[model samples]
Target: MYVCPEGHMAYKKARSLQKNSIKNEKLIFFFDVEKCKCCPLEGICHKIGTKSKTYTLTIKSNLHQEQLDFENSDAFREKSRMRYRIEQKNSELKNRYGLKKSMSNGLFGMTIQSASTVFIANMRKIIREIEKKGA
Candidate 1:
């Protein structure tokens, strides 16, 4: 079971199907049209008279749905808070360490530049830790 991003209850999983020359079959999930009709936020939730009553999600494998389900669990919610700290680190690298734009042209030069930037960032973190410890 998957809930929509807007918190709508999507209760059923439809079968997988491949329509054309697509390589992978798509996994579909659905919400009852009757529920949508009765919902107070119907206009905001879904457009009235839409042809389809289902929400379609494409999955790479059976494990993909399982992964999504795990992500929705309470334990995952607790762990996901750390993602914001990681994002802040990335933002610092881009803004403070000048990783937002490549200084060198060509793939090899870009690789070198990125490596150097990351090394410098790591060194800065080490220096800060040492300073904090006063040793």
Candidate 2:
């Protein structure tokens, strides 16, 4: 979609590697210099002494905006209220349970360790709640 100020259409020149980005490449485009070397719009598009016109198209991250309606909504507030308690529980699991590092190898071992840790934590919570109600 790149066009020079003189209404000349740009064509694909090369696929240039972006130094910082791993997944994206730059599509370099060039305008026909024969039609633009002496173009009156030279200063507007490029420097007046430049030989040819070239540009790269990059989609800015701002173009992919998040849903603003979901940010300050009721559901958002509800989750925000639970975030602290959930994070505290995760910290407890990591410190008290051997969740900071896997005690064994492979997916099966990790699953067993996680299941046991969560089961014990939930059981303790249920016992505490029952004792509180009984008191």
Candidate 3:
């Protein structure tokens, strides 16, 4: 769930080395930065005046394959489920609060519009619960 600044992502191919370690069960993670520099979207990630982008990830945990598979098997599916809720909220904000057509210009105005939409959505959910109780 992390966005790399350098736009490069590397998955290590050193599984054998990690297996030879003391634990003999390890998750070897590699971070290769050079690959990112040569990417197609390098311009967007590496712009002038911007600090050097770095994509660093480390994972050296020792766990059995079955254990790791059990833990991470449904991770991608869970992320997809979470995305649906976020997208629904964004659509609601655009349709109900006019987020697509800003009422005022500038970054500050846009911030307020987004904030208010979130607040309104939460309030509406709470009010519905209260009304159900009263009825």
Candidate 4:
């Protein structure tokens, strides 16, 4: 939530959430700009003639600002990109390959079930790659 300079409680226009890093994070909140038109502090809040007015509030504590700064670095984006790809594969395993539940009851049964499920999934991927290469 945000408050205008004139003391009006602002309504959100949009919100963005970041993956938390050692901090309780509410990444960004965009205040509704339409309400700004009639606001007494409109001129102070934004330029006199612009159609768009945006105000953002980020809820991470100052103590974690260093972590936020690191998230903006190139290394973080690269790591996030790699994580996204693997997460997709993990999702496919659970959803399409039935890796979400064990087919058998005991530990050995669970292990073999898991191994065979992964093996089948890998074989399908290998076949697809070979097909693509041959084509």
Leading candidate by lDDT: 1
Among all windows of 10 consecutive residues in model 2, the one with the lowest summed lDDT is 59-68
User: What TM-scores do the predictions have?
Assistant: 0.45, 0.46, 0.42, 0.44
lDDT string for model 4 (22-89, tens) is 54544343555677777888788887778765676556677677888999999999999899889998
> Tens digits of per-residue lDDT for model 3 on 1-135?
344555445444344344446555333445444665566666665563444443333554545656667657788668767998999988987888677787788999988888887898889999999999999
lDDT score for residue 28 of model 2: 79
Model 3 is weakest, by summed lDDT over 10 consecutive residues, at: 48-57
Clashing pairs in 2: none
lDDT of each: 0.80, 0.78, 0.64, 0.77
The residue ranges of model 2 lying beyond 4 angstroms of the native Cα positions read 1-63, 67-74, 130-135
Task: Report how far off residue 95 is in candidate 4 (Å).
Answer: 1.2
lDDT of 1 by residue, 1-135 (tens): 777655677777876766664455666778877777777777776789875567766656667668888989999999888889989988998999998999989999989988999899999999999999996
The alpha-carbon RMSD values of the candidates against the true structure, listed in the order shown, are: 8.2, 8.2, 16.2, 9.7
Question: By TM-score, how accurate is candidate 4?
Answer: 0.44
Evaluation by TM-score, superior candidate among 1 and 4: 1
Off by over 4 Å in 3: 1-74
Clashes of 4: 0
Model 4: which ten-residue window has the lowest total lDDT? 21-30
Question: What is the C-alpha lDDT profile of model 2 across 1-135, one tens digit per residue?
Answer: 577756778865777676776444567788776777667876777776667678987533432324456665899899989999999999999998768999999999999999999999899999999999999
What ranking emerges by lDDT with the best candidate at the front? 1, 2, 4, 3
